[model samples]
Target chain A: MGELVVDELEVQKYQEQEVEENGLPLVLLYGPLSLLNVFGSESLLNNFRLIKPWESPEIPLHEYLITHAKNVKALVCLGKTELDSKAIHCLPSLEIVVTCAAGLNHIDLIECRRRGIMVCNAGNAYTIDGADYAVGLLLDVLRRVTSGDRYVRSRMWPLKGEYRLGSKLRGKRVGIVGLGSIGSEVVKRLVPFGCKISYNSRKKKPGVPYPYYSSVYDLAVNNDVLVLLCSLSEETFHCIDKDVLTALGKDGVIINIGRGPLVDEEQLVRFLVNGDIAGAGLDVFEDEPAVPRELMELDNVVLSPHKAVFTPESFIELQELIVGNLQAFFSKKPLLSLYKNALSASS
Target chain B: MGELVVDELEVQKYQEQEVEENGLPLVLLYGPLSLLNVFGSESLLNNFRLIKPWESPEIPLHEYLITHAKNVKALVCLGKTELDSKAIHCLPSLEIVVTCAAGLNHIDLIECRRRGIMVCNAGNAYTIDGADYAVGLLLDVLRRVTSGDRYVRSRMWPLKGEYRLGSKLRGKRVGIVGLGSIGSEVVKRLVPFGCKISYNSRKKKPGVPYPYYSSVYDLAVNNDVLVLLCSLSEETFHCIDKDVLTALGKDGVIINIGRGPLVDEEQLVRFLVNGDIAGAGLDVFEDEPAVPRELMELDNVVLSPHKAVFTPESFIELQELIVGNLQAFFSKKPLLSLYKNALSASS
Candidate 1:
């Protein structure tokens, strides 16, 4: 159940071996196993015959999809490739779209809805890891854990004598940018540390005990730390702007585990460099692999290379969620992780 | 109340201005303010006329205490100075000893008992910070937060591609040594992360839910991570030696927020270098400020400059505990942080 390839080689192997004997319906895999080559631990590779099409030297991706994947009822979308209208139109027989990610920014949900393609995502798979990484990054930045490690490794402790003291995490007001599942998990974890949590979401959540601010700037004004866990949309992109950073004040720290575009990278760098803000712990950047040179030089900021949710455990969970949702769709039973909004639109 | 100099200069100023004005009682302070120059935030420095002594070219510390500090009724012991029999003997008129630390290893408890002197320490002041740091170190070590920070800072993400995945911290069996206030707090913090907790203390604690192992070796064999938080005593010196390290196996992690020498530094260094243990997050070392040359080269270990409990909030709490206990003693009231065993012996 763990074979991973949205490419020619695995497809060739699967088609040759079990297509006729198993009589399993074919589903198209979207992309190759990208990061760490981890496609899915939960993929029942033998249960389904897999085929993929790419913009190739011989034939274009649209032609390949129409000719090779025409009868493919399920299309799996990995985060790498954009599943836009062009790609969706090529898969005319596609009934369900399964994505192994919590965020659906990569796939055009509206297009999928117009085609009546039921969409499901990895539900709660990365929530704990995302929350854990956010809290870990915040604690690391506040306590200077990474900086202290570097200082010790540089043999500065013997030369510099006493290191600087870290501020206490307890009693610090932490404002969460998104009060979704990841944000809620972060709140649960921070509760034990005695931190005061407030959140900013699209709307004021009913049952949430903490105060909610409709605007991100107001949330920044009252909190010592701002944790970004919300999705990246046109409206939400650069949500943490110069004004919000200013409102957060000089004692403010930012922990970004969500998409990098959630914070205005240029203004954030300016604030960080000029000491407008205290520090930051960023796992994501505006550009995926490219980080600002100024941030690289600063000791106050901790730079993580977008591997916050690369835990083997979470990947396993994602594999299960993806495979289970696909099976549920085929069985005509209730899909496990069907996008709630997608259901409302379909109805 | 916030003046921190423990040298002759503060003594002279206090003796002239405060001793006569308010008729404040005198107490001898130990050591200069070390590590972030944070002496105490809660210290009612004006509440008592402070005096201090040290062996210098001018006079020996014992001679300075006996001659210049004979009438002093109270002595304050900072962590830097060892309060052995010789130093304790120098304070002849001392009725009470107040220390701004949780550990009593630096002080001679037997001597304090023989002299009928009351000893109190900074109670629960550093507890939250210590626990927070221990958990922080654990999360950092397991998740490779500091190393990832280093990777991104070194500008290796583009060149090297995606960074290696860190093992999940959840579901890892963690064993704590010295399951007192700090260890208990650590357990509380780890609960939400879904980690399994176990411990090795001097004796099994009653009403505690976690499984207890009497020996460190047994604990190491049963757990994936071993956290050292026990007090360093003759019996516990080098408790986590080669055998324990071997038992912990190749994938084991160690988090030390307690005193150094709890784990054999030489053996630990060898194990770390040889890959006998997975990783370590060390805040304390066998020698203060002097880390091993070998440890400096490893990315698996996170080295802190022994400032885990140096947060200003805790420092303030330490100050308050020290002053509160002293005030309680002079007024014939209960000391805030009296050593429990001392009280037991006294009764």
Candidate 2:
């Protein structure tokens, strides 16, 4: 019996050494899609042994999570993953959750708070790229850049004369719906173009020199362009509806870089079709990966997939931030990018 | 005999009263396209009686010019019109020529100079719009804004996975080929986006903050993106050739908002096809209205129909400037937007 016990202990020690050759912490990455290692960050792989459960499509997700539950102290969630109470219960040893995206809509923040599971996100990592994209979409719509590209590609310029003139951006009143990181960056870019900036947010930020509006309708009424960059929550869902579109009027243009549900997309299509509103530059949709068919033919509207934050520079920054957060969490140091004041619960 | 003389005097007085009813100058407008009266600028009509040769297509152009030669003191030249030596000779009484376009390439400046005819262009009217369009094209190319728009419009998002990531604009080293009005405006707008700007112009602009490169090769080697916003002349034609493209390397992008001949179109097409360069955003082509069919299929290139300066606000401003120049000419004041030191002949 003593000889058998000694043999078992030696076998266990060898297995531990094989699994953690570099002595890095073991982190279980659970998500429907496996994107944690796609960037191939050397520092991340050198620091932690990321166990991606979704890599083996044959294995059931629950079984995989249970297999690593005892040793896994951290979970890395991708954008599409949902961390409900059941998933949280399965990860009994999980002390922290790290998301590689800015939005936390997929994560059950309430459950995380209840369980005291610290969460870190890619905070301000996507802000500049997202803001730059919003401006690009707006310029594409107002100046017909995409439509012009199509016309040239279709071999129509030779047949047609000069293209029809587009609207100008200088001196136009631009009302930003959100004054967060992305929206504030948008304001900074537009200022140099001579665009008049205004805003309407959850609460008036003190000392912001831009004119503040109490409501979206009021903001639309006075501005030539309305740019949506606010967060997605219950109170903000469909915040840009038919009434706001009607108030925006025929000469008004709207740009939505935020989540799609923030605007009543169906009404927006109707307004665009009827020529009630001048134009729109949309980067997000109500049902993403599925935009309205009516928008495809409209020359006045510019459509883009939800790729406002997908840039190589931004991805590099995000990878660095993610690596930093994980290292900090394991060391019991302050989380690098913990989104404080979780207001969506109240919203 | 006395009664006959008195009857002739009454006839002359009636003709004088009819001509002076508006008290406006008689300005001869010669072009295949009639665009002067289209804007319906009452101020222009109140200031001068514009004689449009293209209005009566049935009449010969020479006959029309000869008919109005004696009374015409000013001439308005549109884009398609060729005011060569012969045309200038026909209008012996022409004192001033007004073109509502930024480029005066269509006009025979040598002939005008020989005749001592003052020429006024659209000047800074198109500066703001042109700069905005250049920035828009750069953004579209670097961020894949137009391609993403097409991806959504083609209904490829649902079928395909996430679109490929794009290069970010932040921290990019941009090289402006010409630091004139439009290029300067582009530098101003790009500053807020964290782009480091440099330039290569006719001469190093005194007191300009941007670093100046004496040669295009040096500029291409150092910068990540090269923008062509210089005037197209003999010296500048095909300036961005194979050598410059090679130096720009595989990761560089080129934006041409200037005349198309500024860059070698064939070399550009080859470079783009072979991936020698990352991408290109071209608004003007070597031949207007006739873009290379090869460029149509390339996903990295953004094409426009030479519409960089085409905007309603800019057109409105151009109309006002044209009127102001004509008024200033008639009143014998300094020309508002004259092209001093016309150097295309030497170029």
Off by over 4 Å in 2: A1-22, A32-34, A342-347, B1-22, B37-41, B342-347
Residue A100 in candidate 1, Cα distance off native in Å:
1.7
lDDT of 1 by residue, B50-100 (tens): 664542338777887777787777888876568899988877888898887
Report how far off residue B103 is in candidate 2 (Å): 1.8
A286-322 per-residue lDDT for model 1 (tens digits):
9979999989889899999887776888888877787
In candidate 1, residue B200 scores what lDDT?
Answer: 92
Model 1 pairs in collision = A1-A43, B42-B319, B42-B320
Model 1: per-residue Cα lDDT at residue A183: 94
Cα lDDT of candidate 2 equals 0.82
The number of the candidate with the highest TM-score is: 1
Q: Which candidate has the top score in DockQ?
A: 1
Against the native complex, each candidate's DockQ, computed on alpha carbons, is 0.57, 0.45
Candidate 1 lDDT (Cα, whole model)?
A: 0.83
